[model samples]
Target chain A: MTAYTATVTVRLKRGVLDPEAETTQQALERLGFELSDLRSADRFEVDLDAADADEAADRADEMAERLLANPTIHDYEVAVAER
Target chain B: MTAYTATVTVRLKRGVLDPEAETTQQALERLGFELSDLRSADRFEVDLDAADADEAADRADEMAERLLANPTIHDYEVAVAER
Candidate 1:
């Protein structure tokens, strides 16, 4: 089995009222940051002991779908770190 | 100014009771994931109009310190995407 690290990001849908995100955006703008697009997401770093990269990804995806995110209001993506 | 993309990740310090992070970790373990360290953080994707990489990074760090994170409870790191 190979050890892999997965970084998962979960974000609310565009229309969702993410107060935290909104506040951050406003704060950034106030700090003289000129941004074209600003999006906020939640990140998770999971160290996985899996059979391989594929298995790690599969398990991470499953975890995101089942528990890490609220499917109706949030979306998620997983990035596996290269060894 | 150059256009740059920055990804900032903010997380609560260790031992902070992150309900979301805890739940995610538990779910992963249940799904047969063996992990050494699992941390939860918040991610932001910002498209910045800056003079260059250094400027963008400087602005990003300022944003993170002043607004994107609560210094007492949360810490943040910024990653600049290469164009």
Candidate 2:
């Protein structure tokens, strides 16, 4: 088995209300930073033993689908790299 | 000005306690997934008009320093791309 680090990025689907991002944008503007838009995402990195990169990615994808992301509102992507 | 998207990824400093990541790892294990370690991060994507990629990255870096991350315990990276 090879050690791989899988990165799962979960993002809110378009058209969803992102209150946290909105609040962050306002805070940045208050600090004199100009930004037209902002979005926030959650990233999870899992280090595991797998036969190959594809196997690691598949595990991470399942993790995202089952727990990391809510299918109703979030979209996610998974990528894997050698440790 | 050109439109750019700045992606700021904030991660916990090494040795920092990450309860969320630990919990996530345990949850995955319970679901019959095997993982050695896990970590979590926050990614903020900021869209704005800027003179160039450098300017956009600078703004995003400031955002991460001031609000997106806690310098005392977090590390962050900013990447800018054309929209």
Residue B75: error of model 2 in Å?
Answer: 0.4
lDDT of 1 by residue, A6-41 (tens): 888899887888887677677777777677777888
Supply fnat for every model shown.
0.89, 0.98
lDDT of 2 by residue, B1-83 (tens): 99999999999999999999898889989999989999999999999999999988888888888899999999999999999
Candidate 1: residue A61 Cα off by (Å): 0.9
Q: After superposition, how far is residue B43 of candidate 1 from its true place, in Å?
A: 0.7
For the predicted complex of model 2, DockQ is 0.94
Off by over 4 Å in 1: A14-17, B15-17, B28-37
Q: TM-score of each candidate?
A: 0.80, 0.97
CAPRI grade, predicted model 2: high
Q: Cα deviation in Å at residue A68, candidate 2?
A: 0.7
Report model 1's TM-score to 2 decimal places.
0.80
Tens-digit lDDT string for candidate 1 (B1-83): 77888888888987788887667677777876667667888788888888778888887888888788899899789998755
- For model 2 chain A, give the 10-residue run with minimal summed lDDT: A54-63
Error of 2 at A52 (Å): 1.1
